[model samples]
Structure formats: structure tokens, C-alpha cells
Target chain A: MRRIESCFQRLADQKRKALIPFVTAGDPVKEVTVPLMHAMVDAGADIIELGVPFSDPMADGPVIQLACERALAHNTSTRDILDMVKTFRETNADTPVVLMGYLNPVEVMGYEAFAKAAAQAGVDGVLLVDLPPEEALDVKPLMDAQGLDMIFLVAPTTSDARIKLIGQAGSGYLYYVSLKGVTGSATLNVDEVASRVETIRNLAQLPIGVGFGIKDAESAQAVSRVADGVVVGSALVNQIAENKDTPNAINDAVGGILSAMRNAMDQ
Target chain B: MSERPDFSAFPDARGHFGQFGGSFVSETLMGALDELTAMYARLKDDPQFRADFDYDLAHYVGRPSPLYLAERWSKQLGGAKIWLKREDLNHTGAHKVNNTIGQALLAKHMGKPRVIAETGAGQHGVATATVAARLGLTCQVYMGAEDVERQKLNVYRMKLLGAEVIPVTSGSRTLKDAMNEAMRDWVTNVDDTFYIIGTVAGPHPYPQLVRDFQCIIGREAREQSLKQAGQLPDALVACVGGGSNAIGLFHPFLNDEGVAMYGVEAAGDGIETGRHAAPLSAGRPGVLHGNRTYLMEDDNGQIIETHSVSAGLDYPGVGPEHSWLKDIGRVNYVAADDQEALSAFRELTQVEGIMPALESAHALAYARKLAPTMSPDQNIVVNLSGRGDKDILTVAAIDGIEF
Candidate 1:
């Protein structure tokens, strides 16, 4: 937790908004996933959100949903993701890796068992998209006891009162959905999201990361101008989907997009 | 545990209907579901809850929705007597509100400040939004982008009811995708937000919980039918999307050896064309959305995209209880093609002066076909699950008739 806090602090001190890149573990091929994580970290991702492939991913856009489908087709599971994280931690102990996915697989695996597996695998945080703050009462304590950060998402439609509740319940940073739609949707009101992030900032001292519709460098840069971090998911997944069979092309495409977004934000 | 039938109310301690219902979600959601199951067990029987729910059903929803005998249509079919369970008269113009009202009240009782749900035709979303608005709770509804565009009127209605409509643009951009997004939201917000599932599908408690809430449909139909005809109906017919309405109407008559149950599924083009949503007819048993049930999946076990003229029936999976029922041979499942359902939609509107949602028309079409074969004195109860106001645009577009 302290290491994660410092990562955010360092990004703040450097005047650089954190770049949190999301990738579904075991996409394209299970063998490539750990190498992809290393590649992402080497490409300057501040935090890595390792997406556990779920059969149904409701909050995802077409790109990530397809990525999950591909990963699941390859027989990826919670154990496969934990194996990826364990491998990821061998070289990069300081980079925070967050497990983001739906709750069914985790529930099937058992909460206490999952938390223990995650901790043992060197996972730092988790974000189950359908587990609301109130329902997180039991799981949050388990995660807390296991020293895993319980990440939460706050949508534009979230009420102020509920926002506060989520802020208090969430650990690490808050993920603010930029639009009132699923991931990969194109219409994003960045100014509106920035203001919402401001409100969240006032409510809690934790770092805020904006996601959902940051599809390109311009959008990512715009989001970075206001929020503490920018999360680019659908765009990256789309790149992966377009070049899944060609590893170099997949890496090149994602690297190009990330590099451009990073450069734009740095300016 | 005795062989004697238990007429007890729900959140059935072990979560079963004679070896059917039980919690099947991921371990992460088990504790929350267990909490909900326990809370509902306590509240369902509590006098205060019973009184409050009864009052809402009486005044707010204007329930005990009339059970009308369709004399003209029954005569035209030239067979068994036909009766319609008027769920379309319920508030929000569909049977979905029955479960929404019960679940929303439960949410309030559990001290949940927010509610989330997934919608296909937007009936459930509208119903949920209406109840949430009345209760002054924050509501978020996830709908597929295609549904948002196709069911534009309902999208606006949900927004008007003060619920946030989040369009899911993933995985076929239909009902299943919307379900995925709602599940994501529930997992993320599982602490305080109660997920109001639109259908009697999903994992253990939801299938049982929704059926128990919607069983009011069967309970009322049975009582009213017996009072009017002095006997149980010979047949019960209802369309199966997620199978909530069908299960609701069928549960009360499950043990009646003489009563035949028919669940009509949507055949988009035809079952032979491989473009349909007839889960029981075309699908194999598989686990999806928290339950092990029959699903239209490929050889790789990936859920396939289902097509139907009625947006409500375009789902790859049927409710788990439906799976069990099909396995036990207690209920027969059949399919009605898009063309057949469309003709029935028009036939019912012109013959009965009632515009039925395309989903409900599938069942109506099946009833029309089956009525001619039944004896004159036999009775058939058709569940008119929803009104067709939401389908005018789609129907008009299909007919190339602009207002």
C-alpha cells in the first residue's frame, strides 16, 4: 500500500499524470502475457491493471470484451492470472499490479481463497466491477486483512452521497468513468469528468484516474490535464485485437499509441 | 424435507424448489447473496414488509390486474376456452415490475442507497427506474447500445424516471452484453448497490427470488381461473426470454398432473436457419451469468449471438429453472418464428384491440396453433406479459409505414 501510495506521489511530484495501462492477462496466447506485462512496464506504465478474463464483461467495450473472449477461449482462469502476477512480481516488485474483472469467477474461487492467492501472488489491488461499496463490506475486510487494495469506480451518474461512501470504502486510487456508458464509447465530456474528479478530490485525498472513453492521445492528454492519472483501456485492447497473431505488430501498435499519449500528456 | 408439498413463502432456507434453486455465483458474491437471502427470509414474512408490499401492489401498481376471458379469440380458435392473465395492465405496462417492486423494497429494507440492473427491451429497466424514483433511491440501468437505439422510447422513459441509462457497446451489442455490463457494475459496487436482475435467470437466489416475486402471477391466475371455471386450466402458455413470466405462471401449476405447460421461445428466422433465440430448442446446458443453464453456445462454449424480431427474446441463455424443468419433462418448449409472431401480433391487436409486445406475441401465436387441437371444454391461460407501446417504432419500421 505504501509503495502504491509512493508511485502516485512520485507521479504528482514529477508533474506527470500516472499512466495506467490495462491488459487482459493471457490474451492472444497465455505464454505472451507475462512478457507483455514486462513490455508495458518498460514502456513507462506507472500502474498495471491485469484484467482477469471473465466469460461476461459488462463494463467493457467491444475491444476489451473481445479480448476477454479470446483469453477465455484459451482457457484462462483466476489461477492463470495469479500465475501471471507471480511471474510479474519476480522482476518488478515496486510497480503496482491491480486485478480488474467481474465477481463471478472470484466468487466461484471463494473470496478468502482469492484474497490469499492474490496476496501470495504479489497482487496489490483488485477492482470487481459489480461489487458495490455496501456489498463490499465483507470482501473489503478480507482484502484489507490480506493487505490488498480494493479499488472502486465512480460513474458520472453516481450521487454525491454515494461518491463519498465509495471514496471511504475504496483503497489505492478512484477510477472515474468519463461517460454514462460502457468502455470504448466515443462521446466523452472531459470538462464534465474533470469537474467530477475535482468533487471527488474534495471528498477524499486519494488519487483519481479517469477512464472509459479516453480512446486516443488527444483524449488521454485532455484527461491528464485535469485528473491525477489517465487510464486507457479500450484503445489498447483494440490495438491488441487488430494484431493478436502478430506479436511484434501488437507490441508496436500499443507501444506507438502509448508513446504518443505519454508524449502528449508530458507536454 | 417431507414429500408433502410445502406451500411456504421464500428465500427458501437452503434455496431450493425440490432440488432446483441454490446459490451458484462466484465465491466473491456468495457472502452478499447469502446476506440477501437471509434478509429476504426475514423480511418476506415480516408483517410490516407484507403490509407495505401489499399496499404498494394495491395502490401504486393498481394490481389484482383483471383476468379476462378472450371469448372472441377463443371462438375463432375453435377449441379450448382461452383466458388472459392481464399483467400488461400493471404499472410500466409489463410483468417486470412485480419483481422490481419486491427487489427494490428489499433494497430499501437492506439499507441499500443505490440500485443497478441490466435490460434487454427496457421493460425491466423502466419498471426498476419507476420503483427507484418512487422510493427516492439512485438507480443505474445498463442496456446494450443496440437496444438503446432500438428501444429509444424506453431509454427516454427510464431517463425520465430518474435512472441513469448506461449503454453497453460490447459483445454483440444486445441483451447478453447489457447483462455483462450490469454484472460488472454489481461486482464493482457490491457493497451498497442492489442488483435488480430483470429476469428469473442468473445464479441461485436470483432465479428463486424473482420466481417467488413473480409467482404472484401464477398464484392469482390459478385462484381466478378456479373461481371462474371451477377447475384448473388444462394448459398454461407464456413466452420465455429469461423465462421469468413463464416460470411465474408455471410454478403454481407444476404439480398438477393434468395441466400441460408450454414455453414459447423466439425463432428469429427459423430454428433450421440457425438464427434464433430458442435456448431450450437449440442450446445445450452450460454455465453462464451465475447459473448452470441451457445456453446457445458454440463448440468452444462461447455464447453465440441470438437474433429475434422481439428484442426481449434475443438472449443466448434461458433461466436455470427452465433448464431443470426441461430436463424433468414437466414443461414442453417450442419456438415461434418472427413471421408467425408478427402475424399473431397483428391478429391479437385487430381481434382483441390489445397491442401485445412482440415477445408476448410468440406465446399468443403458439396458443392460437394449439387451441384448435384441444377439446372445447378445456382451458388455456395465456400470459400477456407486456403491452406493445414500446414496439411501435420497430413494427412501423418493419412495415415501412411512417406516421
Candidate 2:
């Protein structure tokens, strides 16, 4: 809890929105995963969210789904993702890493086992896209006991009563979806998101991370101006997918976006 | 030396024919799959569930549809006799209602108050919405926006049944996209909502549960065939679109070695044109929508868009169990192109006075071709999977004959 608090405190001190870059482990190639994490950190990514590949990812769009298919082709598993995190921690321990995915892989690995494995892998948080706060109560205690933050998504449709429940239960930061549809959808209601984030902030002090449709530097900047962190997922995954066959294209594309978003957020 | 063929068994423990059925999903969905499996196991023995399902099958959906002998068509073909299993007469104009009724009962028994489904051609959506309305459960259906336009009447029917139809405009904007959206809804509302999968696919219990529900088709056909002809038909035929209707008609005869099972898939153009949905005929095994099945994919393993005159048959993948059956050599999977199916669609309407759904016409086309080769003493039973009332406009548009 203190470590989590300090992570947020550092964000406050910086007075700049944290850049959370999400990448599916083993996307282009399985072997490049560790180096990719290091590259993102070097490129000024504040927090790294490693996506565990699942066969059916309902919340994702074609970009992430394609990335997941690429990862699965390489036989990426929960164990492989955890091992990648462990290797990531070996070089840089201060930077927080979160596992963002659906619940099936974690449930398959068993809750206690996943919690322990995640902690051992130096994972500070987890965000199960499909698990609502009410349904998460069963697993939240386990993750909380293991010192792993269980991040929850607060959409525009979320009621005030539900927002209070999610805010109280969620740890690390609250994920505010910028749209009603799945990831990579074009419609982004910035005003709605800002107000929803403000509404959620009124209920809790947890850092707010805005994502879903924050595709470009301008959108990231717009979101970061209000929220504590800006999550760039589908955009990065889309870049990786377009350049999957090219050599070192993923790193350059992702690095460029992160640099641009980081600069924009700093402004 | 090759071993002698034998076929006196049901789906093996893994829901397979030989190499066809097995649970192939990521570990997270195992619990839900297991829960469903356990529920199905208990429900199989529960007299109340069976009684309720039987009641609905009989009175509600108007089951025990006649097994009519098509004497005129069979005599014209000058070969084997042909028997029609009249699943088209089922309520909502298709055999889809059989599985829907069974699953709706299971949903109610499981204490789920809401039902969600995905549709491609809208037949399954209409059936699901119809049952949900009857049971007083809230229903939501995800359909591709393209499908919504092509199947506008069925979409309206679903809305009239008090169900919300969500148009999915993602990915290919077809059946696969609708499936992705539906899966998302299921994951979000797993606790209180029952996902009424429309076919014999998805993770474990769904394929098994749906097949069991639809097996009534094969079971009734077998009894009726025996009573009418005093012997099993030489060939059993049905169209394969995710393999539900085919599986329903084929499961009972799976044990009869002498009975040949033919599952016809849609070849939109010719297979050479690369615009077909013939999974078993030309596809590789890959994971999609929770199961490892035969799917049309590119070299990079990305699923490719498939085409058929019938929107229902325009899915890239076939049921995994069908893949197993093909592997074991128990079922001969064949393809019928759009022109062939269209001709059969016209033939059935003109000769038999029955207009078959374009999806089902593929099997009728194949059966018509096979009839000329068989002896007069032989008999073939074709599953009339659905009525063509929902597809008249589609069929007419394709033929440049506006209705």
C-alpha cells in the first residue's frame, strides 16, 4: 500500500500526466518482449501494462485482437507473461508493471496462484476488463492481501452508486473509459470523460487513468490535461500490427508515439 | 491392411465423433464451461427440466413435424428414395427453435433472468428472441450491421419479440464480428445472463449442450425413418453452417455404419475463386469464438472473410465436432456452389412446392446430385433445416429476379 501511495505521490510531484503504454507480450516475436519493455521504460513510459493473450478478447478491437493472435501463435501464456515481468523487474524494479487482460487466464491459473505469481513477477496491479466491482469482490481480497492493486474501469454509463463502490474497491488508479464501445472505437466524448473522471475523483483519491480512443498525441494530451494518467493501448497495438513484418518497426513506431504523447502531456 | 469401418456409438466423452469434439478454450472460461457441463449433466437426469423441454417442443414450437416421403422428386431423380425431415415447419420457420427452446429452459432452471445471443442471418436471433419473450426474460442480440441490412425482416421480427438488437460494426462486420461482440456481452454479464449460442460451437458445454438439444432432430428422424421405410436410410444429409442442423440430423445415425452422412458446405463461387465458406472442404484448424475449429484463414493465421448467397452460411469456420467427424471418415463433407444451391432453391420450390432457406439448399443440391448415382432401392433423408420464407427476397435479388 505504501509503495502504491508513493508511486502516486511521485506522479503528483511531477505534475505531468503519467504515460501508460500497453503492449501484448510476444506480439511481433516472443523473444523481443523483454527488450521491448526496457525500450518503453527508456522512452519515458511511466507505467507499463503487459497484455496477456486470450483467444477471445471481447473488449478489444481488431488491433489488440490481431496482436493477441500473433502472441498466441507464439504460444504465449500467463506463465510466459509472468516470466517476462520477472525479467523486466531484474533491470528496473521501481517502474510499475500491470497485467491488463480478461479474467479467464487468471482464473485458469487459480486466484491464489496468480496473485503469488504476479507478486513474484513484480507486478504491482491487475485490471480484469470483464470483472465488474460486484463480481470482483471475491478476488479483490486475494489480490489486496498479496499487495496487488486491482484496477477497475469506470465508464460514462456507470451510475454514481456504482462509482462509489468501484472507487472504494479499486486500487492504484481508476481506469476511465473514454467511450461506450470496445477499444479502438472512434467516438470519444472528451467532455463526458472529463466530467466522469471528476465525478469519480470526488469519490476517491485514487489516480485516474483515461483510455479507450485516446489514439493520437492530441487525444492523449487532451485526456492527460485532466486525468492523472493517459493510457495508449489500441493505438500502440495498431502500430505494432501494421509494422509486424518489418524489422525493428514496432520499437520505432511505439517509441515515436510514446515520445510524442510524453511531450504533449508535459506541455 | 485398413481396419473395417464401424459406427455404432454416440459422441465420445469429449463430445467428439473421432477427432472432432474437445474443449479448446483459454483457462479462464473453464469454470464457466465446467459449471455448464455440470448443469447439463444434472439436467440430463432432472425429470422436471426434461418434462418442461418436452412440453415446449411439442406445443410451443410444434415439434414432431412430419417425415414426408418426396415421391415425386425421388421418382424424377430415378434413383434412391428421398425422405424429408420437416424441420422447416418448426415455429419461427426453422429447426433453430428446437435448440432455442431447450436452452431457454436451461437458462430459466439456472436462475438466469436475461439471455444474450449473436446472429449472422438473423434466424437464430429471431428464435432466441422468440423464446426469451415467451419465458419473459430480457434478450439482447448482436448482429453484424451488414447482416442487419440483408436480413432486415428478421431483424424487425427480433425487435417485435421484445429483444434489443445491437448492430455490430466492427471487424469484417459479419458473423464473426457479431460473435466477438456477443462474447464480450457474455463476459461482462456472465453471472445473471445466459449466452444462448446459436450453433454447435464455442467452448465445451455449449457445443455439447446445443448438440444434445438439437439431437432430437436425428432421434425423431431415425424413429420416423424406421417406421416409414422399415430400415435406416442409406444416406443422411444436411447443410453445415457451424454444423448445428447437420449435427442434429447426424448424431442418431452416427452408430449406423451402413448409413452415409453427407454435410454440404457453401462454396460461394467456386472454391477456386477463393470466395467460399467450405471449412471442412478447404480450411485449417484454428481457434475462433472459444473453440478450435476448421476455419478459412490466411497464411498468417488471420481469419478471412467467407461468402455465400445465404448470410447464415457466410461464416469462415465450421463446428469442431464436424472437423473430428471428417477426420474419422464417418461423415463426407462436400461443397455446393452458389449457382448449384440457387438452382436447387428453384427446383425445391417448383417441384416439391417447398422453398428452402439458401443455407439448407446447399444440402438439397448435393442430395439431388447424389440421387442420380444411387440405386432405386436406396433411401436418403435430407434435413430440411429451415424454410425459405425469410430468404425469398435474398434469393430473388441474387437471381436478378426481383420479387
Candidate 3:
């Protein structure tokens, strides 16, 4: 089993829900990303969803979009994010790191080359926000060949037919978008998410980590009741955005919010 | 490249047009695309769907748009006969309405209660809104904030047609951003929403479906050309912005061995300056907005910000079919700088008494250059994709005048 599957298995044995914190790899600055990744793990994050900044993040709202702009302004590429993962592996080898982004950068770099390089960089999983399983024929095999998990997002609108296909294709835990709007947009209905997560659980055996619209620790705690994992993105990225110029403060700021959510989920 | 490709076999069952187009969306959108694909496949041959589409084109969209020979402009050029396929005369003042009407009909048939689209110049937005209004469907059009500022009149036009125009303010604040926003909306509202993509880009079924709908331009132009010029034109030219208009005119002529095809891109300042949006002319192949196509990008694989005086032609990527056609040596992709397009826009207005859309002016500008080099017996048909009425304010600003 991959690190992601093992991580989920360990959590399931302990009867503990996993806490996943997402942050853009090069948001604010590149020099701060490795430190931030380490900090996220130290803050009791079971998984670190490192965002590889894309020029156009269609699934994201203004918070993550602006985070991408800040990262792009520094000309941060997927290679750089992979290098950051390599750096994180120097001190940490157990915490699974998932590189999340759109499909263009990996596509431009040739899927085989990216998968090979990612394996060399000690990457555990990849979640291409735009690449559905139907179109992942070229990239998925390469990632699987390297023993890397290919994660997928299941939205509230995803039908049961597609959920079965996603279950068959995807290897890592599925990320469930909790709402109908873009990430960072308001209004999370816990009841609706729990019901959909139930449906998804019945279809796919993989752990479901609910992302999007889970802003605060309270919301994360609520989502953790029905989800195997809770992913907090915009709220952490908002802290990173708030502490952009002061790179030293980002670790504490992102760590503080994620630590609160981790504690809240653990409770 | 030596052997000609079978155009009929394109976009194989997997939606690969020579490895250029595919469904690159997330799982959430993949199901929606599959449903859309099945619906489009079913209705493509349905008699009722065909009749409804034809009725809209003829009565609602004013089909058989005149194939007027620009005699005065041709004489001024003094080389070749220049024929204008006046798609600008359509009800919504652009060929964009052709695809919109067809998609709206599909939306109605699919029992979708709403339709959404992304637009840069607002021409597509207005056209989509117009169709939705006539069909009594709720419409929402995503446009870039910069475009909303530049194309204020078109923004108002779309709103008047009952669309909620949402201004996207991310990623250089242009058409690419608007498309991203629209895709987000579609993923969020997949149950009751049908996304009417305004270009020949995006995932599968969309490029094919849009082409099938807009193919009327080429069909009408072909019949008119045979009637007026007594032969197929030497060349067919149209501006390409995601290449809907150009592909619309060029798809029907792909099998005509004697007729050459040119797809023009907007060379904003000049391609030399590296500030233009002429991806096919100067870019490399990459994936963006769902398909692998020619794209302007930086060395790090990030999409480069593109510029163009015409909002419609300002995207960093072109259509996948155009990319396939370019690679196979079937279509010659070219570019027209902003100044050249403006000059053609002015010349066509003053000389031919028809003001063309800035997007169409690119084709006219290229035609002007090519027409001056050919014999009078030879002819070139330029797809006048839209009217300049929506672009009057932008054109007026260049002359130090304001509305």
C-alpha cells in the first residue's frame, strides 16, 4: 500500500479522523514552503496537501486564485514544488505529501517525466483537479508505476455511476467537495455533506476527505463526524495571504489555524 | 504530413483530434460531459432537433446571410475578387448566435432549466443571452472584469437580454479567467445547467458540437460562392479565437483540395514583441481549458498573459481542431497585428459601407494583403464573423472620440 492508504489505515485503527491541511507550495514565497509543510505535519496534520500553483485554478475562488497569482509572480513551477517535497523529505519521511493542482504543468512536462521526477522527489500522491479518470489514461499508469497514489475529487453533483468509476480508478482517498460553489465561497451544509459522504462510502471503499467550504475549526469538526478526513484549504491559505510579506510569520499563522482544526477534529 | 488525413474520422470515439482534444476536466465534470456527449449524439440525428435548429437559424438567426461581393473594396485592392460571407448580418450581429441557438435547443431538449457561457468580447454572451431569452431559460454569462470595462456596450446588451453577467477578476482578468469561472459554475450546477461553450475549444463534444452547429456558415458560403464566383474560392479566411468562426467556415471546405484555408490570430502589438495572442503562429503545444492545443506559455509551463485590441482574439490558446489542422499542414495559421486589423476595420467601413467586427477585421486585413497579390479571377471569401456595432466605442477611442 502507498503512504496515503497506510496513513488512512493507521487512522482507522485508532478510530481517529485524519486532519489534512492544504497550502499553496509557493504562495507568498518559495523559501517558506518547506518550512510550512513541516509545520503543518507538526501541527497534527495527518496529510499535507501541498498546492502546486496553477495559472488558472477553475475550481478555486478568489482566495486560492490570488494565492496562485502570488505564487506565479515568483515564477514557481511544478518542478519547484516537487523540489520542495524533496526538501521536506529530508526531515520527514512518514507524513504523506499530496501535490494538488491543475493538469497543464504536468502535461507540459510529459506525464512520464513528471511521474518519474515526482518519485525521485519523494512525492506520495497527486490530485490533478481537472483530470478525470476518463482522461487520466496517459498519466495514471505512470504514477501507479512509481507507486504513487492518483487522487480524485468527488463533488456533490457527481452521480453514482461516476462514483463507481472513480472508485475503480482512483487509488488514494477521495477528496469530496462539501458545497456546490467554488472553494472559499460560503455556506456549508453539514447534513447534505454527511448524506453525500454516506452515498460515496457505499460506492467507494476509500476514505473520503471532505474539502471546500470547511472554513473554521468548528466547520472542520462538524465535517470530521461524517468524513474520514477533513481538508482545510482556503482558511489556511487566507492566513498565508494575510502573512505574505512577512515570511517568518506564515509558519505560525498557518500552524495556528491548522492546529486548532486538528484539535477540534480530534475532540 | 504528406498524406492527407481523413477529416471525417476526427475526434475518434475518445475525442482525440490527432491527440489535440480530450476530456481533461475533473471527475465532477466528466460525468456532465458524458451526459452532454450522449445527449448531443442522440439529438444530432433526431428529426425534431434538426427541424428546431433549422427553424431558429432561418427565422430567429436570419440564416442564408448574404454572400456580398465587396466590389468597391476589391477594386481598391485591385488584385482578387473579395467576397464577404456576411455572418455579421445575423440577428445577434455575429455567427456566435448560430452555435448559441443550437446549444439552447439542446438545453431545452435535455430538460436543462438554465444555460451558462463564458465570453470575452461579450458577443457570445449577448448571443447566448438572446437565445436563452427566446427559449425562456435562465442565462448567466461569465466575463472578465477587464472585458466588462472595455466592452461595456456588449455587457449591457447581454444584461438587457436577461443574462446575469458576472465579471471574473482573476488570472490577468481576461477570457481565460472567464472560462475558468464558467467551468466552476458548470461543475457546481451540473444537474440543471448546460454550459454553452462559445468557442471551438474546451473538452470534446463541445468542439464537435459547436462546429456542427456553426457549419451553416461554410455551407451557405459554399453554395453562394458557387453561384456568384462560378467556382470554389482560391482561399477562405477567418479570424480564429478559440477558432469557432474560422473552423465554422473552414470545416466545410476541408475536403476541397483546390481551396486554401487561413486562420488568423490577433498579433496584439506584434508577434515579434512577444505580446500577442497568436498561439498557432508562435506558440507550442500544451493543455489549457480542457484540451491540448497550441498555447503561449512561459518556460516554466505557466500560461503567458496574452494581449489583443479585440477582446475576442485575446486568448492564449486556440482550438484543438486548428492545432490538428496546423500539424497536418491542412490549414495555414497566420496573424494580424492590432494596427493592421484597425486599418482593415476602417477600410471596410468606408469602402464597402459595412463595418465589420474587430475579430472579423483580422480576416479582412489578411485578405487585403492576399487579395492584392492574386489575379482578379481568383477569389477569397472572408467570414465576416460579426458586426462592428458592438465595437464602435473601442474603435472610436482610437480616433480620440468617445460615445
Candidate 4:
């Protein structure tokens, strides 16, 4: 919680919007993850949302879905990704790494055991897309005990009442999916998101990060104007997909996109 | 949870059948599930809604489909009297229509203009399409590409009923993949869409509501068993895919201590071969789609590919209620290998002229094995959940006979 809070606080003091980029940990291969994290940090990412590959990423679009498929095709396990996080922490301990994915893999590992492993691996937080708030009571306390901020989604369909509950329950920052559809969906109604963010701000004191349709630098800058953080996922994942065959180029390709988004967010 | 459960009340307010079920879905879908759950709680008991549901079942979907005495087949084994709960006679040729008609009515009551569903053998697709056509609602059904090839007639049937059949090519290209696509559609078009999940699976209210809608099967069979036979049967047997038919037939019997219930899952080769859709038989409790249930997953929690000759019974995950029942010892979940189910499919058709879907044949196979072990005075009712007309093409191909 302190890592995320301090990162956002630092960004706020600098009068700069936080740039959050997401990548599947084992996408392309397991060897690229640590270097990619370092590359992303060098490219001006304030925090990293590391996606854990799940067989079924129900809410993600095709780009991220294929990313997960590629990762799984290489047979990436939760322990392998935790090892990646541990390796990343050897040189950098400041950047908050939020592990994101579905709940089944975590459930398979058992909640408390997975939380302990994650905390020991230098992991900072978790955002399970499919673990709705209604059922989150099962594992939230376990994650909390490990000092992992349990991030939750605040979508357009969520009521003011739900927003309040999610606000109280969530710790790191609330992810506001900018549209009703999945990540690669083209429709990003900035006006509607601004209005929803306004309402979300009123209901919660947490910093709001908007994603899922913020594809390019332009969309990132537009979203950054309205929210505390701008998150770009599918666009960067799509870039990785293009350069997957050349593993050596993946970090530069992914980091290049994040650099452009970070530049745009600052502008 | 270790003690015998209070079977009457399940899927508690947040949709939990003990630790097996809960609303495990995206935030975008939470409000929609909440809305549907509240609506179902209100309408499940409303007299007008029940009347509409009953009237449609009686006139439109063909209710009280017979508790048939398969005496011809029973005498061959000559150990016990075997009965078939004839859900295959229902309109659209399966027990799937019972839940579809009920959900269609619920969709109408909710004032939703569009409805969507996913199907494997296309029984649920055709049933959903049939109701949508009758009610003047736009409908779409997602089917795996492999199923679209094998169950061509049902695909045509669904399309003829005006449902746009979308062929899903992802994952294993089977029912599980189709469900994933359908869930994606429902999540995207949630505002005006009512997803008529064909089974007692998925997130909240779905597992509870679909079971409630189909429980008429067991309720009617319970009454008919008393009327046709002298008393309740010694055992209730049903095939389980996502476990709708099994749960429908099992839920009403849960509290009856005298009634022993068995859920038959498809063991494609054998349990030892590790190629089957028998989650309860071989899987561990894990989350999939939107519910935590027994799933065919690997040690690392990746859902494994499942195989069954029957497309409908090919799902890797069974329903949450079935998981709960299996855990509580209220239901015995066993598996029938492909060859056993195929042999039973042929035997029932030849002796009783009752062609069973391959999915239902799994139950028939188990019943055939169990029937010979009991006395003639005893009885067992196997849920013949669907017609085999959809499987004719696949059967002919297997027999080296071209249609």
C-alpha cells in the first residue's frame, strides 16, 4: 500500500500523471519479463501492472488474450512469475508491482500460501479481474495480511453505492475500465468516463486509473487529463505480439510504446 | 460443511452452495447479476409468473413428459425394473427447453429485448432459439466450430429458428470455448441483453435459477414414480455435463434419505486414461467461467482439454451444486467410459425404441450396470435428458455408414 501510495504521491508532487503499463509476465518467454520490467521503468513507468497468464482471461480482449495464450503455450506457472518478480526486485525495490489475473490459479495455490509466496517474492499488490467484490471476502484479508493492496475495478455499471463499497475495500487505486467492452475495444467515450470519474472521486479518496480502450498516446493523454493515472494494456500487448518472434526486440518495442504514452501523459 | 447439509436452502443470498458457488465475475457484470438475482427471487414465487411458466410448459414445451417403464430392456438384464424419465419427448427434444422457456419468460418480464446463449450439441441453442422466435426477441447462440461441424442439423435448426449461430474457434473449440465466447458477449452487451445460460453453471443466480427452472423434471417424476410404481424409486440417475439435468433431477431428491442419487459423468476413455469430462470424478475444486466448481485442470491450475464422444457432456467443469452435493455425500458421481455409453445408446434404441442422446447414454450405461445388481422389486429412474436425433450423423460415421 505504501509503495503504491508513495508512487502516486510523488507523481502528484511533480504535477505529473502516473503512467501505468501492463504486460503478461511470461509473454514471449520467461526470460524477457525481468528485463522488460526494467525497460518499462527506464521508459518512465511509475508502476507496473504485471499480468499473470491464465487459461481464461474472460474480461480481456483478443490482444491480451493471445498474449496469455503465448505465455501459457510456453507453460508459465505462478511460481515462475513470482520468481520473475523476485528477480526484478534485486535491483529495484521502489516500483510497485501489482500481479493481475483470474482467481482460479490463485485458488489452486490456496489463498494464504499464495499470499505468503507473493509477499516473499517482493510482489506488492493484486488485481483479480473476475473476483467480484461480493466474493472477494474469501481472499482479500489474506492479501491484506501480506501487505498486498487489493485493487478492484470500478466500471460504468457499478452504482454509486457499489463505488462506495469498492472504494472502502480497495487500497492501491481503483481501475476505471473506460468502456463497457474489453481492453482492445475501440469505443472510448472520454466524456462519459470523465463524468464517472467525477462521481467516483466524490465517493472515494483513492486515485483512479482509467484503462481498457486507452490504446494510443493520444488516448493516454486524454485519459491522463481526467484521472490520476493512465493505463495502456492491449496496445502494448499488441506490440509485443508483433515482435514476439524476436525476443530480444520485445523490451524495446514494448518500452517504446510506454515511452510515447508517458511523453503524451506529461504533455 | 462436513455434516449433512440443510438441502432445502442452498446458494445463500450471495449465491453460495456452501463453498462451491459465488458470483465470481467481472465488475462490469456484478450489477447485472445482482439485478437478475433479485428479479428471480421475486418472480420465482409470483403466481402470475408461475402461471405463465406452467401454461407454456403444458401447451408449448410439452410438460410432464412421461415416466416411461422400459420393461423390454429391464427384462433382458432381469434384475430390477428400470424406468426412464422421458425429457427427450419435450419440445426441441431435450430437457434444455424447460429452462429456456422459463428464462425466456424471465427475460420478457425483465423487459430485455435481446437474449443470448451457448450450446454444445445445439440442443440448448435450438431450444433457446425456439423460445426467442416465439417471443419475438432477437437471439444469438455461440457454438464451438467442432460442434458446428458435428451437430450440423441442430445448427441448421437453430438458424432456421432465427438465431444467429456464431461459431467459436478458440480454445478447444468445444462447449467450454463456446461458453467463454457467450460470456464475453453477455459482458459486452449486458445493458440490454439477458443471457439464458443453458445449464446450472456460471455466476450467481444462474446456478440457482437454472436448477429451479428445471427442477420440474424431478418434481413431476417424484409424483409420477408414486403413481406409476408403488413408491419412490430405489435410486435416481442422471447424466451430468454442466449438471443441469442431474441437479434438476437430484435437487428434489436431496432431502429424501430413502432416495439415493447418482450423477453420471462422461469418462471418454477411462478415469485412468485421463481423457474425460468427468470433473466430479477426476477434477479438483477451482474457479472457471464464473463459478468455483470441480474442473478438469492440471497441477498448475490451467484447465485441461476434456474429451467425450458426446459434445454436450464434454465440458471440463461441472456445476457448483454438483460439487457441493459430491462433497456432502448426498450424491454419488461416477463415470461411464465412451464405449459403455455407446453400447447403452444402442441397447436402449434397439430394445425400447428410445434413442438417447450420447450425453444421456452415460446415465443409461450406469443404470444398466446398477440395475442387474438389484432385485426385480426395486426400481431406478434414469433421466433420458435429450433425443439422439442430433447424434445420428456422428453415430453413422462411427458405424462406417454414410448418411
DockQ of 3: 0.67
lDDT of 1 by residue, B127-149 (tens): 99999999999999999999998
- Residue B195 of model 3 has an lDDT of 95
Q: What ordering of candidates by TM-score runs from best to worst?
A: 4, 3, 2, 1
Best by DockQ: 4
User: How much lDDT does each candidate structure score?
Assistant: 0.84, 0.83, 0.90, 0.91
- Note the residue pairs that clash in candidate 4: none
lDDT of 2 by residue, B132-243 (tens): 9999999999999999999999999999999999998766788988988887676546668888999998766688778888999999999998899999999999999898
Local accuracy of candidate 3 as per-residue lDDT tens digits, B191-291: 89999999999988888999999899999999999998899999999999899999999999999999999999999999999999999999999888888
Ranking by lDDT: 4, 3, 1, 2
lDDT tens string, model 4, B1-403? Answer: 3566788789888888888888889999999988998899999999999999999999997788999999989999988899999999999899999999999999999999999999998999999999999999999999999999988899889889999999998777888889888888888899999999999999998999999999999999999999999799999999999999999998887778888899999999898999888999989999998999999999788999999999999999989999998988889999999999999999999999989999999999999999999999999999999999888888889899984
Give the docking tier of candidate 2. Answer: incorrect
Candidate 2's C-alpha lDDT?
0.83
Alpha-carbon runs more than 4 Å astray in model 3: none
> What DockQ do you compute for every candidate structure?
0.10, 0.09, 0.67, 0.81
Pairs clashing in candidate 2? A104-B28, B7-B255, B19-B324, B20-B324
Comparing only chain A of model 3 with the true chain A, what is the TM-score? 0.98
